[model samples]
Target: MDVIARAGRGMTRGQEFRTVVDGAWSADPAHRMRWEMSLAFVAASEAISLPVQAGLDIGDRTPMTAMLEAHFGCRFDTTSVDLDTEPLNVATRYPVVTAFEVIEHLYNPLHLLLQIRAALDPAPSSRLFLSTPARKPGFLQSPDHFHEMPRRSLEALLSRSGFEVVRCAEFGIRSPLFCLRGVRPLLRCIFEKIRIYELAARR
Candidate 1:
């Protein structure tokens, strides 16, 4: 019996969520999520007209690192840091950092964000792209989720971390159209899509 694979069944961690029990990566929801996040990052990167020369992916537990690097025309160092037990360390200064749906799983997301800010290049154009779930239609405290952040709380954390939010675009909508099959724009609450934000270091 595939114990390791079995242990990962239905897990919400990055790698586990991207992987299938039979050792295949599903492209349905997981890949789609990654693509959307990459789109956000690409848009953010383009906004500042800064090439993603060297970046860090805070918790990219998937194989999309290469794809993301290629898409951004640069390399992104990937990490699978255990936010609960591991201390945040910035090996090298990065002009760009991405933390998709990672902060909610950490005990002290603000602290982590501050640490990440410290590691970012001091250039005003340097950016951090992040996303996390909102409080609406909040999921129960499961083995995966530590906490959810509403818009106010999310903004507070970024400000406290000395990062200025450039944009915060909500995606999910909770509406009848969302339930309808083959809807062009899925209707769900902004919180549901995990609020994606583009931020820059304070001058």
Candidate 2:
């Protein structure tokens, strides 16, 4: 099956859902993931200049929704897409869409990107905001990420998925002193960064 081939083996709907929920999904910000969310919001604001009528948030019930609500003046909605199973069907197209820290968790991100492209509002100012953990040295990475894409690779995937890159930024989530914790932490301090992209659908 193309879904299996593209997504990876053994990622049946049941399997992927279990894997995702167990490790990646979160309901709300317990306190804050200050670095990640703030950075993504900044990128999103700069990406779409028009007033946001509504948004489709991919991972439902996460901090992304609230941060986006604030960014979009609390006018957003969520599709709560099960990236592997549910399609992004909606009565209205979203002017803004966000999937922060979500691509790495997915068994297949391309499918979701393609869906967002197809479902985006046709207005030229409509945009999608996606962020993923940057590819790091092996010692600095999570064991479970389905993809920690290099910047270029991510750009290429977006291009092929029918999005044109508006901008991309890379930054660390922690201070330099975060490395002082351990040898591995040192590697993480040097290599750990998040890449956020602002994209608009191709003409």
Candidate 3:
């Protein structure tokens, strides 16, 4: 097996952790847990429990790829596509996990979302793990953010492409002092149970 595949196997065997980074890591547990869950979900679904032919990390860049490699201890068969220069509408070697504050940076969120949707395997079990900033005060912290997306806009984009949003919820820490200030976890739990975010699955 190649390094990427071997690394994937190691991760599936519970030998190493996995992550995808878009920025420097914060000390916040909520932030860390959010990414951890996203990675674990993708890894478990494809690499661990089932056969994942290949995986794509769209917008593959230094920080994100570094995080993925460090945590997973594997070099995924990654594609570093920048939407401004090219399209990502091609078959990948495995399932995809586009995580850690990536979608908002895209110049064309819907276009890229469609590109990912097109690349999925026809099998209903194939999955994509996506994380984007929910509409909130801290969501616009980055100057590079092109869009401040709410649940409705994200759902519409995913629905139009043929993906059924299987899970969608905001996860973040708004204030360090007060635990009650965190609304993302509560909201996400509710959505996950009711299948509110599952609308983007292929339908």
Candidate 4:
């Protein structure tokens, strides 16, 4: 399957394979329930998104970051560093928005998450937003991905790192076959239709 096609299935199914061969449909409801509570809290509060410090262009040119900025009317400061490099926080840089998309590409997700947490300015209301493929199969499909993160494992990692998940949901929608002529919005519409499993965490 192609990248998007593979990503579509991997995001939803990859993690369940390791935990239960039966299927994700049976296992994800409980996971989603936990995420819902986390998300509701974020929706009620005003929190900033974290910026991408490194690895630009991980997925589709940072659509999620731009969307959040537009929607929330918040500006973000970005830093660039590899997973192995330590994050630099200059006096001029203070980020409330730290967004990492397609981060399954990183070698150590837990370490990266911790690094991100440490880099942020300590505010009780500070929040972080993260999304990764639900499992290893999704990681394998992407040339850059180093690991696939299952829902439960990811939740544990976030919690251990002092984050409380607020919302989580599977994102993606199957596109309809055949496009009408002169409709430029078809792809955009399809993408907008894509459901994302989103999570909001706060310390």
TM-score for all models, in order of appearance: 0.72, 0.78, 0.59, 0.53
TM-score: the better of candidates 2 and 4: 2
Q: Residues 1-203, candidate 1: write the lDDT tens digits.
A: 12122111212244332223332433445445645565655565555554567888775444555656766678888654554445556578888777766676666677678778888988877888887766655333324555777788879889988988787776652344445644333323232555788898887
Q: Which ten residues in a row have the lowest lDDT in candidate 3?
A: 5-14
Per-residue CA lDDT of candidate 3, range 130-162, in tens? Answer: 766566455323454556576788777777767
What is the overall TM-score of model 3 with all chains considered together? 0.59
lDDT of 4 by residue, 145-202 (tens): 4555566777777788767765555543223432233365354323322112333345
lDDT of model 1 at position 195: 70
1 versus 2: better lDDT goes to:
2
lDDT of 1: 0.62
* Model 1 ranges off by over 4 Å: 1-31, 37-41, 44-47, 138-143, 173-191
| Model 2 misplacement above 4 A | 1-51
- Each candidate's root-mean-square deviation in Å? 5.6, 5.8, 9.9, 12.1
Error of 4 at 150 (Å): 1.5
Q: List clash counts for every candidate, in order.
A: 7, 0, 17, 18
lDDT of 4 at 30: 34
Q: Candidate 1 vs candidate 3: which has greater TM-score? A: 1
- Residue 15, candidate 2: how far off, in angstroms? 4.3
What candidate 4 gets wrong by more than 4 Å, as runs, is 1-63, 90-95, 136-140, 178-203
Candidate 2: the clashing residue pairs are: none
